[model samples]
Target: MFEQIKVFFMKIWNELIITIIVGFFIRSLKKSKELVKPTINELLNNIDYNSKNWKEEIDKVLEIKTTVERHFPEYKDYLLIQYGSSVIPDNKLPSDYDFIVLLLGYPIEGNRYMHNKGTISDESNETNKDQVDIVFRDYLSFLFAASAGMPYENSVIYNGKLVKGHQGYFQWLKNITKNILFDKDFLIRRFKEKIIAEKQEFHKCLKECEEFGHDEYYVIRAGYYYITSILQLRRIQNFEKVITQNQVIELSKVRSFYEDILDDNIRNKYEQLVENLKRNNTLDLISIDDIKEVLLYIGEEYDKNK
Candidate 1:
């Protein structure tokens, strides 16, 4: 696999860099809980296993099938990537959307559930909001709910949701927001709202970066700045919950707390990405020696921080 990957990128390094950078914006491998969050399994959901609303949600979602055909034509071929239903017993209103959308993986494409990144941070950039995430089998084993039904939008490459216009996308939301789709009929519309909020947060962060004197031209750029900003907020929020100010004695720590959030193998792959960026002058198609210089430069950053 390593040799195959190297050979694959060896042919088109530029495309790889552009992809890694942008792809990371949406497909970031979030560190899942090794042990679930401090919540009792009870805190994890909105309803008990048996609930009347859960049945209602299924009825509502099924009714929206017409909306998809009428609004977005993409589902004309897409399949049921995932079907789940569950209830969050506590009845908390919600901080963000609850549904976790994922595209079916294997070949890794087509109809799939979408990750609600918006709920994670409340920033809804058009591009990020439009992402259609793929899921590995058994990845989120939590999907056995008896009621939730989602129409995973098609994989979006750039200009728009593939084959479906904004109308199709709106149908997707209308179907879910009805709150009649989840097993417990828990409302998951908060994700849509949060995505919008995150985009606003990013604009705020970018403005701060500029007002604080970071050059907007170089300092504030790309979809990544937006993604990283949300990541920062999540870190700050999660850390605040368990660790206090004293715990943050290491003020300059970067990506350390985040290290645990993702598995080592995935994190290591990102490290290799940094190496490739350094070694190959990810900006330029160049010789081996040029890449060597970049590697040395990256090494110095760690050394200086240490």
Candidate 2:
């Protein structure tokens, strides 16, 4: 009877030990998940552009402003603006941000100097990989580009929150943006430049693919560029401003046109390539020629419609 009692207690003790171990593991897992996943506010607040960490860079730019004003007194009035993905309303988790120093007066030498020397080269090299971009723009060129429905039209002028600059200048830019109207000639010019640029980049990506192995990511990117380029051209031809973000909404229509009218496998290949890229970061499934063919088809179709 004593032996039986000892065995039963031993079994109970063993089960209790196992239960404690499992409970500890579960608690640890929950804690790990909590640590790994950040809240939306935390993610946004931690962005490099908004973070206090980039204050040094911002201060450097401000110092540069002093140097610029001293050297080129004519360009004393200027506005430094931050825009791009960082300022988009719905873009809560932007990869990085873009800053533009807009000069009101035409101080060519000072503008060039700032454009060439405004950045920390080493930091920019690393930050480029992280998606940070900075540029210098004269007010006239900025106005022209904004009127032409350039991609930067979608960006917001930073309102003294992250970077320190003239609030009056920032407000001026906002007002100008609000009042700017689309210019057809500039839109056409921008469209041509866009097409040429995308084509050149596509060719470069193809060359890299041939030299190295095929990269699914580049292939998918090239496909998207081609589609968007075509859409932009069509819009320009119709005297409409290019709608940049609605591609996914129009994907089915584009696919149907390619499949039924064009009777080409480019759409299927593009879809598959995108799916493969999403599933696996590294894929060698697509060919350079495949992208070239699709681009060629798009070009031909654009010409036909134009």
Residue by residue across 37-89, what tens digits does model 1's lDDT show?
Answer: 43211232343327646533432332223433453334332222221112223
Estimate the lDDT of model 1.
0.31
Question: What TM-score against the true fold does each predicted structure earn?
Answer: 0.20, 0.47
Best by TM-score: 2
Q: For candidate 2, write residues 1-306 as lDDT tens digits.
A: 999999999999999999999999999999999898543234435547765667555646334476446554666666656554456567655345555666667565546444422323222232131344444556565655554565433243313232555677666655665534555566566777767766776677667877887554454565656555565556445554433322222322333343432534767656544443333322456655666666676778877765
Name the top lDDT candidate. Answer: 2
